[model samples]
Target: MPESLMMAFSWLDWLALGWFFACWAWYYEYSRRRQRSKRCLAGVMHGYRYDWMRRLLGREARIADATIMTHLERNGAFFASSTLLILAALFGLMGTTERALLVLADLPFAASSPSRLGLELKLLLLIGLFIYAFFTFTWSMRQYNFCAILIGSAPAADEKDSTPGLRKMFAIQAANVIDLAANQFNYGLRAYYFGLALLAWFLHPLAFILATAGVVGVLFRREFHSKTLKALAAGRDLDITFRGILQHEETTSESLKSQNK
Candidate 1:
């Protein structure tokens, strides 16, 4: 809209910010489609999650599984609480927006001092990002709660033979729930990652562009080529024979259970 509303950022600055968000959206879609087949960590982890649910079928003691779910919930809770704290700090800083900008303006490298409206605009953007992250983390926590419930209701080892169809169905559902929660937690983390880039806007538009690119590049490399991915992939036997068969057998467990009779 109005230039005043736009703040210190020019059209190019706004476009760079848009580019930052666009990359996030693009990666999300690409990951959704290719995760199962690709070499990305997400795909590998998805396989593990699926395999985990299948093994739950053979296990009698579930305390370990419940413990894992509790850890996931705790992670989500930590991020959700952290986001709220940041949001509160943002509101507090909003009152001194102009005063803070004046201090920055004194610095030689600091870009132009923003108007009050401009300062407010930037603070509002920060607040919005935190709010988004808060919601994503909280939702992830809820999904983890649901995952716990699913685990509790999951079929037992002996019961797996009796109701193979139901076991497979529950296994798939549990894996999906866990995957969805993990995805949401990741989304919140992405928001935090991009928020680092947004901070560069306070310095200068060019810094903003460079910072955004840096953030995207860092994230891209981690997802596709990180040493962690390589380490995770290194368990080729587990990856191929165990996790792979775990997934395929779960699909056929329903029919095979009947054929055994």
Candidate 2:
């Protein structure tokens, strides 16, 4: 609302900013909806996670499972720590606004020099993005810790007291937990992609708009149409047969239990 801040951005800049946020929000919803009936990375990986939990229940030795979980937690920790460092650097940069403005002015592609307030606002936007990422990453870590607890409590394959129905339910619930944690991690990573695109805003609004669109396109390809997704989808088809075996076991166990009672 400051006069200088008002002068920093033209109508085109405002339009570009609006476009950036709209694209981000709209793509998020689109991906979420598309995954329900489509073959996306998130949907395919979730199927694999369910398969993993089912296999985990069948194994008595789970040290490898625990190690995998630890590695995932470490990844979340690394990202959260990195986000904090970047935020610190951005905050420090605020103290040298005059020098930053000079650097921008020297750039061949710089559209216009921003006022100190404008520069600060840009930094603030970056700060907000990273703050959201930090929250998501940290939350993901906590969820993974919860998953560890679930892993610890999971029923072994040979345990007579655990019925097949109970085991199946446990695997489904635990897989859901893992999927939730993964969703948080994905959200945090998406924030990083957007933050990188937002860097173009310092040069020109049009550049920022184009960069944001580019990031969204890349995300879309990787999520829904990449080689990785195709590979996973192929594997998921095999998983269907694997799940069928588990269902058969469940049904046989129930029949035996009913006969005994």
Reference-based TM-score of each model: 0.87, 0.90
Clashes of each: 0, 0
**Tens-place lDDT digits, model 1, residues 82-136:** 8988998999999887688787688676566556676677789889988999999
What candidate 2 gets wrong by more than 4 Å, as runs, is 1-5, 241-261
Error of 2 at 97 (Å): 0.5
Alpha-carbon local distance difference test for all models: 0.83, 0.91
Question: lDDT per residue, candidate 2, 1-261, as tens digits?
Answer: 777667777888888889999999999999888764439998888788888999999999999999999999999999999999999999999999999999998988977756677778889999999999999999999999999999999998799999989988998999999988998999999999999999999998889999999999999999999999999898888778787999999999999999999
Which candidate comes out best when scored by TM-score? 2
Question: Model 2 residue 110 lDDT?
Answer: 79
